[model samples]
Target: METSLLAFLLISLAKVIVVVVILLMAVAYTVLLERKLVGRIQNRWGPSRVGPFGLLQPLMDGAKLFLKEDLIPEAVYRPLYILAPIIALGCALMSIAVVPFGADIRWKGVDLFEIADVNIGLLIILGITSVGVYGIALSGWSSNNKYSLLGALRASAQVISYELALGLSLVGVVLRSGSLRLRDIVDVQSTHGLLSWNFFGGFQFVAFLIYLMAAYAETNRAPFDLPEAESELTAGYHTEYSSMKFAMFFMAEYGNMITVGCVATLLFFGGWTSPFGNLFPEPHNAILLSFLSLFWFVAKVFCFLFLYIWVRGTLPRFRYDQLMGFGWKFLIPVAVANIVVTSFFIGLRLPLH
Candidate 1:
């Protein structure tokens, strides 16, 4: 028994380390992807001098940030200011623990693609994301700068307002799947290929739309990025943060972006499942199947990330009042309506008692 327990612990620790490393690498490349794409949108070359077509730019950027001087203002509250970015980045990475990236294959009697496959995986992600707000709020409050405080206030309000819509958007998926376990949710969608996906067959496309908008706001991306609106907040909540501390906030944002994409793929798209359904034969080889599953999952997530960048380059940021009004008067109501309609359809499809 002791031997088994020790093996489990060792495997779990290994999985955690691997996931965190991969996630950080993904976050770095995602920044590079955004910059390259955004540069093309403006007809300019970005990071070209750093490496051949800037392929090595993320590595250089990481080295630069690491070498930069750390700075802390004298007026700020020492403890919370120091703690804020760690909290933000920590929470962002924590949400991924329950996210499954590939097939349900096991090695050494442990999950090959996930860390901590909890029954309430969906709830756990939501809870961790909610807690991440504290990092931004604390950073703002502790900074002792009006711009920082204002940015933090905006972040807090924006998150509070949109988080409701975000959570509501997932209700239809949860109801349709009848399980909070992410693997179970994926299993339900795997039966019919693209049509079985929540975005299509399950008729949760409305929920998916809500999830997208709310996710953008939650992650402070693009038009909804009021907290860090460059024209207004002068770098916003992290304005007072510098060096590695600032890098933490930057990494946390991208990490959250990746997490959101993962959830979207799992809930709306048929995660790790081919869009063509069972049109193709299933391979008997477990190793080959695992690689194929990982490919599909990564492909879907890449598409989602591309969409995120497209929106960032194309859309204009919303004014503060407009942002608030849209969340409360538009998104929240639409999300609620989507939930009700989904529930009604789900009820109709239920077998009589």
Candidate 2:
């Protein structure tokens, strides 16, 4: 028993280390991705001189941020100012703990894809993500700058306004799956392949659309990035931050973007499952099967990320009032209606005794 417990501890620790390192690296490169894509949208080359095709740009950027001087303004609130970015980035990283990236395959008595298989994984993600807003709110107040305060306020308000819709949008998925465990949700859709998927088979496309829009505001990307509107608020909440401190907020945004994509893939896109369903024979080799699952998961996530970049490059930023109105008056109602319609259909499909 003692040996079993020790093995579990070691495996868990290893998973944490591996996932964190990979997530941080992904966050860095996502920044480079945004720059390259956006630059091309404007007919310009981005970071071409850094390395072949600017592949090494993220490495150079990370080094520059690390070597830059860390500065704390004399007038700023010291404690919260330092803690804010930590909270932001930490929450962003923490929410990924419950997300499964592949099938429930085990190796040496350890889950090969996920860190934790908590039953309430969906709720945990929602709770952690909701708490992340505090970091933005506190950063603005602590910075002793009007622009920062305004930016933080916008973020706080924007999150509060849109989060209701985001949470409601998932109700359709939860109702369809009849389980909060993300793996259970995926398994439910796996039985019939593509036709059984939530977006198509479960008829939850409305929910998917709602979730996608709310996710944009939740992650503070372009069009919904009112909190960091440089035209009006300069550098926004991170205006007073420099060096690695500033980099933390930058990383947090991209990290949240990745997390959002993962959730969307799991909930609406039949995560890690092939669209062809049972058309292909399952590979007998466990390692081969796991690799295929990972490939599909990564490909779906990349599509979501590309959509994010495409929208950012093509759209204009929303005015603050328009942002608020769109969330409150538009998304919320549509999300609620989607839930009602889904519940009706689900109820009809249940066999009455």
Candidate 3:
């Protein structure tokens, strides 16, 4: 018993470390990717001087941030100010733990590629994302500057407003799959062709669209990114943060984007199920199949991230009132209606993919 427990703990530790490292690197490169993509969109060179087409730009940025002065303005709520970024970053990173990267591949009794396979994985994901709002809200409030406070309030309000639509959008998916466990949702589409994906012919396309919009809002991405509107609140909640503290919030934002993309990929894009499932069934060599699954999973995630960066380049930010109105009035109602319609048809046993 002790040996089994020890193995579990060690494995858990390793997974945590691996996930954190990969996530941070992904966030860094995502920044680099956005700059390159956005620059290409605007027909200008972006960060070419850093290194080899600016591949080392993120590293240079990180070094600059670390070498900069760490400032804490007087009159701020000292403790919470310090704690807010940590909380934001912690919540962002923790949410990734519940996401199933690929189908569970066990070799001689030990699973690989996922940290937790909780029964209520969906609920845990929602809960963690909801708590992330507190990090931004508290940071804004504790900054003791009105601009920071205003930015935090606006950003938190935007997140809160859209969160309802986000959860409701997923309800249709949950109903269709008949499970809150993400792996089970993936299982529903496993072995089927491309249309088997919820985004295509599964009739959850509406939910997917709503979820996509709400996710952008939830992660404070463009068009929905009124939280940090430079024309309004400067840098929003992290306006007062500097050096590594500011980087923490920056990392949190990108981390949230990664989590959002991962959730979307898992929910609507069939997780790690290959598009060529007919050629490569799950029963084949466990090791080789697992690697294939990993490739497919990463490819889907990269596509989602690319879409995110693409949207940032193409769209203009929504005004504050327009952002709230769209979320609360249109997005929420559409999401709730989708849930009802989905539940009704699903309950009747319609032959949905």
Candidate 4:
């Protein structure tokens, strides 16, 4: 029993290490992807000289950030100011533990994919993500600067408002799938084929759109990035932060974007299900199917990520009042109405055509 437990522990640790490394790598490339894509959008070449079209740009950027001087303002709340970004990055990393990479395959009688297959996976993700807001709020308050505090306040308000819409928009998916388990949701989507994906139906497509927009605001991405609106708040909540500490916050933002994109893909685009269903069904081809499904999943996520970069270059920042009004008046109402309509359909056991 002791030997068995040791083996189990080592396996778990290995799985965790793999996940963390993958997330870190993804975060690094996401930055590069944004720079390149945004540069294209703005009609400029981005970081090509760094190392082979800037393939090494993230590495160089990371090195520079690490070597930079760390600064903390004298008036700031020392403890909380330092702790906030750590909390933000920690929470962001926690969500990925529950995310399934691909269909599970047995390896020595153990599932080789995903660290934990918690039954309430969706709830875990939502709860972890929601807690990340505290990081932003605390950072702002601890900064001891007017602009930082204002940015934090804006961030808090934005997160709270958009979270409601984001959560509500996903209810349709939960109701239709009849399970809160992320893996189960994917299984159902796979069984239903292309048309069965939540985004295929009209109402679900609207929910997906709402969810996407709200997610962008929740993450403080472009147009909705009022918290970091340079013109208004200088550098916003983390304006006073520098060096590695500041890099933590930057990494967390991109990490959260990838997380949201993955969740959206799983919920609306079929997590790891092939686009055309079992059109080429073969009992022994489950592994092949899984690969195809994962390919489609990654492809969908990449498109969303590209959209994020595109919007960052093309759109202008929203006015404070306009941002607040849109969330409260437009998104919230639409999300609420969507929930009601979806519930009605669910109650009637309406078959999705």
- Tens digit of per-residue lDDT, candidate 4, span 212-319: 999999889998999988998999999999999899999999989999988998899887777777676734676775676567777888888988888898999889
lDDT agreement with native, every candidate: 0.94, 0.93, 0.87, 0.87
lDDT of 1 by residue, 146-251 (tens): 9999999999999999999999999999999999999999999998799999999998988999999999999999978889988888999999988899999999
Q: Estimate, for each residue in 1-353, the C-alpha lDDT of model 3 and write its tens digit.
A: 13477788788888889999999999999999989989999999878997799999999999999999999999899999999999999999999988888768864355668888888999999999999988888998999988889878887888888889999999988887889988999988775747788887468889999999999998888978776788888888888999999999999999999998899988898889887656644666777878878888889989988999999999999976788789989999999899889888887887656
| lDDT, candidate 2, 172-243, per-residue tens | 999999999999999988877899999999999999999999999999998898999999999898899999
Per-residue lDDT value at 214 in model 1: 95
Off by over 4 Å in 3: 1-3, 279-283, 350-353
TM-score winner, 2 or 4: 2
TM-score of 2: 0.98
Q: What TM-score do all the candidates reach, one by one?
A: 0.98, 0.98, 0.96, 0.94
Task: Give candidate 4's TM-score.
Answer: 0.94
TM-score of 3: 0.96
Name the candidate, 2 or 4, with the larger lDDT value. 2
The regions of model 2 sitting more than 4 angstroms off are 1-3
